[model samples]
Target: MTAQRSGAGANDGSTHRPRVAVFRPDDDRLRDAVALLDSLGVKPVADSMLAVEPTGALPRDDAAFVVFTSKTGAELVAEEWTAGEETVCAIGEPTAAALREHGISVDVVPETFSSTGLVDALGDSVDGSRVEIARSDHGSDVLPEGLWDAGAYVHETVLYRLVRPDDAGESVRLAAEGDLDAALFTSSLTVEHFLAIADERGQREAAIEGLRAAVVGTIGEPTRETATDHGIDVDVVPHTADFEALTEAVLDRLEGE
Candidate 1:
């Protein structure tokens, strides 16, 4: 469905309908994004950029508590690991909501919803605590490092790994062809992979600067640094991880004010 709001799109003062390229995992993550885009009357080109690969490791049933950094991580843990007496700590509301849907009550949902946010929210409770952190193999070291420093006994399980999907390059090509008015990055990994694909297509600078950027939380913060290096000004950031907020960020950019 093509969603075009009147007087929204392009900075040239033309009434062009804005099209946005979305690079997210192809689960509810992508679905929810599309739903929000539809509600906002903005067209979205849904593109799957990352796929989750299971590592065949489950969270230890005997752990004191468990930490989930992403919705995918929570989903994987909920699927393979039975709920014990462990308190679940979900890094973000989306991840926490995913766990709650499975009859799980999350003990903590951080304000920032990042690794550092998780550590900070857990506070001294993490001290002398045995926490099992489930995330991708290539995830940031902030959680483990913070837990260790806080005197927590950290047991980490690589529940999944993120692999670049084959269609990502095509999505980058579509963006480079001026088919996209904006690009929304929900994760830093997406930013890295998108830039890599653009670099491979030999228009990394143009792709980085030519389109408007809307980021979610700190996920898109790192991308802004990269975009700034290419002289691209980031247009908006939801600062919250919610898809609805992200949709608004896109709408704000589409209006070109």
Candidate 2:
């Protein structure tokens, strides 16, 4: 069920900067998000949501093509695996940049930066070729399924598991209390984990209500669908699927209100 987008204009005639919750993993990503939000004049509530747990597994070496879907996956793979003759592909610029940071050359980066886009970018070239997808356990099934449909022999390696941090419910408390003015959900898993924590804290309904009243932003369609499925009214989704874009778009919406 989709609801009409609503603003957190709860502070209509006040001087309070919107308190936007960010659920980036605790690391440079979280810090960067905080800096971006602060620069945009929003009070960022830093909530570390996803934590990377490396599985210590490497991609199969005999594949004809290797695909990476995230910066974390790229970094993990680069720690132990070196790109050889297999063509390397990234889902987006950030993953490609991470690969390059480890001296791995990226061969393909789709214009649209999604599983469907990668399938279209690879086109008929993967026919009968062995392609290996290395990513976290929470990866969407779209990429592997699309590759198999494209006549590629696909192998998936779980390079890491994205676990919710032990102490991650601060934002949930804030939302349940109607203190959050906006929230940036970067992935579907983030949306799920956020609600899981809310449920744990016995504040799921209250948190959902708070988010619906606030400006909810997602990174892409998948994330938006996840939030909407959970009854959250998503107000902003930038054309670009990155934290900076998502944050800026949510900030713009908040400012407009």
Candidate 3:
């Protein structure tokens, strides 16, 4: 999600700059969110719950079409200097934008921005195609399974592994602090990791209950459910799953408060 313009506001003549806890694994997207928050005069507690570490080697020119479940996976292709030109399918708009920055035209982006939506979107094209489903270490299974059912020659690439930061102590502490006005969760894993880190630091309950009124912007419905399961009350879920929308939603929510 690239940065988009929005207006700034403060409640009741208070100089309280609303702070947000942001957790997205990709660098570009995190930057975009940070920039948006900065533009709105909101202080962002920017820290990724998960860090992307490259793991498996990328197969050279092996795919006619590839599915990227995360922006980090799509960026790895550019970082490793892998040859472009393969038809790419990104799980969401941000991943597509990242690929487009490298001049790779995205063939498809799921209307629903989920694995099932991508599977349905690729229906006939996947058949007889050399497809690669590339993602982080704890990669998902539904996309590859659906492609195989479509009769595609599929290769799974674990380009990187997403691990919780070793020094999440500060992040967890800040998240639970009363001054934190909002929290942004880009994925279900982010919610899980945020809570896990808080729990690890013995602040899970306060972090969850304390932020009860904070505008929790979950990127999608599934992530909303995960946030709900963690007892995080979600205040907004954008129609499109991108940081551009998330930033807008957070701003709108803050304005309405």
- The numbered model that scores best in TM-score is 2
lDDT for model 2, on a 0 to 1 scale?
0.88
Tens digits of per-residue lDDT, candidate 2, 58-89, equal 99999999999999889887867888899999
Sliding window of 10 residues with minimal summed lDDT for model 1: 212-221
TM-score for each candidate, following the candidate numbering: 0.83, 0.93, 0.81
Task: Tell me the whole-model lDDT of each prediction, alpha carbons only.
Answer: 0.72, 0.88, 0.76
* Candidate 2 regions with alpha-carbon error over 4 angstroms: 1-14
Candidate 3: clashing pairs of residues: none
Ranking by TM-score, best first?
2, 1, 3
lDDT of 1 by residue, 1-257 (tens): 12355424423434445667677788877888777675566667787778889888888777787988888888776755667788888888878988888878888888896778888888888788798988888777778999999889998889999988977765577666756666776666777787788888898766654564432222345455555555456666677755566667666655654
Deviating ranges (above 4 Å) for candidate 3: 1-14, 59-64, 79-87, 100-105, 127-130, 148-154, 169-171
- In every candidate, how many clashes are there? 0, 0, 0
Error in Å for residue 121 of model 3: 1.0
Positional deviation of 186 in candidate 1, in angstroms? 0.7
Scored by lDDT, the top model is 2
How good is model 2 by TM-score?
Answer: 0.93
